[model samples]
Target: MKRIPRETMVFLLCSTFYRLASGALLVSLTWNILNQESISYFPLALAILCSFIPAFVTPTLIRRLTRKFNGRQMSARFLLGLAILTLVAGACRYDTSALLVTNLFVWLLFLLLEASLDMWFTQVQRGLAPAQVQRLSGATTASSQAALMIGPLLAAGLTPLLGNLGFSMMLTAIFLVVAAICHSAGQPPITSNDTGSDTKAQELPLALFIPMLLVWPTLGAFNFMLPVNVMVQGWSLLELGILDASFGLGMALIGVLVIAGVSGSRLLAFLSGLLTLSAAAASAWLLLPQDLLFRCACLGLLGMAFGGARIQIRAAIAQRLDEAAVGRSVSRANALGTPVLLVVLLIQLGAIATAWALPFLMVMLSIALLMRLALQRSQPHSAAPDATPYS
Candidate 1:
């Protein structure tokens, strides 16, 4: 793989830190709420769904902000705002309803911040060669896993000392301040494209979005079903943690290939396209005997398939779209995609209501995930003009 620019590496580090802080805060708040006997799933679900639904408006927010600010300035301002919001959330930690409300806004701010940051990254990557783009893209995606694992660990350690809100607040202020500085150091001088839409932004191939859209629900089912399966079999939390870690390991393994900028054979890309691979893994997970090792293997497979597919889709999108349009395109995807995920997750919740229906429901989900492959195949393979390793 080509050497990634130092500026890009530092920018990625900034992005990772911001992601880690946001993830830690959100997870900490949600964990506290879940432990409360008085809180119901409806409110928690609503809180999450509400946080997601507002993301459709992020494009408009980014458009207006970029008119007055560069990506670095936008990131700095938002990071500071998020830090303040976390402090406010700390003040409201004693009130259940207030805490939920605070958590919702905190997530909403994070979403907006991410959209702006992505715009910045899109602008920055424009200076790189295609191969360099691939490396940076993969590294950013791989580093993103920090938000999932390290973020949660941060929440756990901090919660005992300062409580959820306090740790979140402290981390938000500390990490985001540094994130702002790194972001400034890493970015180019404000280009017109940074402050406005690119006139020459290419039209994206929407067909590629199928995998990105399926990404959420596919993973959601995996996330939703695996725990239920573990509990039904009366497994310990340690076993569940191990299974989760195995899945994370699989994701990391795939990330390495992506970062190395490995390419796929045409035959391999065709046979192992996003939907097919995910369905195979999901099916194996649902059908195979519930041996812990087997379940772990299946989950790992699902993670690898999901991560590889997601990277492929993103690389294609990056190849097409430019600054503002990139952010808007992603916002649109989230707007449309998350609703599907919400629906799928809701169905899974209902399916798990009865013990007999667990495996059947999972089978149905695997089938649903597989059905997309038909749509995928129906589309022209030329959908991605650039043949990526992930493709």
Candidate 2:
């Protein structure tokens, strides 16, 4: 197997740290908002809605930016801008109106950071062989998951000591600065011929789209509801952090295993869907009960499902699309599903009955299962003989 280049590794590391800071900010901001005496669900929902805007807009913006600046430069500028925004958000933390405005800008910056990193990785992928792309993609995801594991703990510890507003923002800004510096280190340009137009293009399998669309919103809804669940259960920040960490750990472990060929993607997706479905059922039937252990267990299951499903979806895309198209394909996939996710968030914010949440989750699970079965039935026998079960 070809070794991943040193520069590529550095870029991945920077991306991981950026992700860590982003995740930490998200948890802290959401916690702070929800903890408010007034309980600002509309602002929280609006913030989430704001986050998705860059997903639609950034692709075109990135294309233009890359014309003037290299990927590394673009990423650094975005990170620095994000750091500044974090400080501003911290300064404005006391006023609800200011906080909401700052939070919206902060999410926009965060999304830009993600978009820049995605563009950087897509370039890196263009330079590697298919096998290398698969390997590095898995490694990159696993590292991000590891960051997720650490981020919450860092946030929980810092929030109490730093007072959840200006101080936490300052600390997060420092992390972003570090990420900026690391990302600014130049990487060798990918010059691989594999990304050329002559390479045969395969239509993305319909089955892959199932996980692609559902996994993100499913996870989003879960995360969106989590703080409320934790509060209702009377759990402390530390416990909530632990639950968040468990989910990340599950994702990291499962991602590494799937990348190593321990299991097939479809099978993992099926199992994950079932696990998520079961967890949702338990949560609903039990009426969002207060047991910490049970909550942790459910979170862990959700994390594992998210991790596995993400890997499966990405891997399937990698298998089908050339490097040039992978990034755009992913962006399109996410864009297509944004409306669905928005509706889920809207429902949550509208003070819709909690009873409806479980049913919505079940519907998603059922669709995933049916899609998997349909994919299997659609595959011809000859293709089956050559296909890796996991692929």
Candidate 3:
């Protein structure tokens, strides 16, 4: 067995923190605040609205900072900044009148943390051999999901003792302190070891970045519609939550298998197309009347599809770009895509729309894109060793 690099370890740690925040308490924390009438759901809504803020800026920040500072140095600065910010926001979590204000500040801290992770992830992209990305990303994701499972339980157990505000504050403190420590343990950035080739990386043009940005949001739009569709079909929250957990389980299981097999580029791309098709088929199934069992199956299938696609795309991206560029590229993709998702979700929320059908459409379209890429990879004219970021 190969030893994991230090960067991968840091990625896993950040994943743990992120999952604890986003996956664990993300919705439930909002639910708690809304139920208590301490803060209107509007703030939560706004935070979601602004969720992609860091995605748009992070890439640019990396581009600028990496020229001067090594990856580890930049990551350390980012973590330290996030720690201070989260601590300050945690201190203010108890002010009800300031709930929205405090929440927004906390959100800003989160965005910054995300940016920091992206910076460190840049190191992972540059340092690891191409074959290692799948396991590394999978490990990062696994730690995150594991944290997700733990975070909710932690939040629940602690809420009883600490109150809602106190629990959030405690989490805030833990994340900041832990983040700072993790950064200190990381290795210096790739700039420290020059390959001695004076070749500067070709910057990804906006044209390329724009398409990548649009793609994920289109996929995300379908995800945002799932709960709405389920509710419209009159499924209870218990049913929906159960279905979601099942979906997550499917993804987790597949991801674990892929890591174990050390899945390769060809298999990754093939699965990308295959999974997109399955997701499309599952979404299309929603057009029919909802059968609880059938819907559960479809959700699980979609989860597997998502897991496959995620690993494939991540590998593809890592193959072509530096760590800083990859994060920025992904952030670009996410930032643009999230707004589209938001709009589509709003449309789904409105009357007189076939919003339920959108996920199927989006998935099918993504499948079409994947199919094209797969075909391109097969063509004799395709360069055997092109190094374009998109390749």
RMSD of each: 5.0, 4.6, 5.0
Please give, for residues 1-391, the per-residue lDDT of candidate 1 as tens digits.
4566666776677777776776566655654554443334455455555666666676677767766666666777777877887777667766768777777677667766666676767776875666566556667767765455466556666677887556866776766675568545745555444533444435443445555455534544454454455556877444655565566556666667777656333323432543465566667766788798987787666656656555555555666666666666666666565677587667666666443233224333433433343234346573243322222
**Per-residue error (Å), model 1, residue 17:** 1.4
How high a TM-score does candidate 2 get? Answer: 0.79
* lDDT, candidate 3, 296-342, per-residue tens: 66755665565555555555666666555555566556656666767
Collision pairs in model 1: none
Give the alpha-carbon lDDT of every model. 0.59, 0.62, 0.54
- Candidate 2 shows a clash count of 1
Per-residue CA lDDT of model 2 for 1-391, tens digit only, reads: 5666767787777878877887787777776665554454566666666666556765566545555555566668777777776777667666666666767677656645554565567666654555455556667778888898888888888777777664566666666766667655766553333334644444454456555656546656766677656666677778878877877877777667656855443454555454565567456436755567766666565566566556555555655554334545555556665677788887776664472364246334634653463356446553343232224
Which wins on TM-score, candidate 1 or candidate 2?
2
Judged by TM-score, which candidate is best? 2
**Candidate topping lDDT:** 2
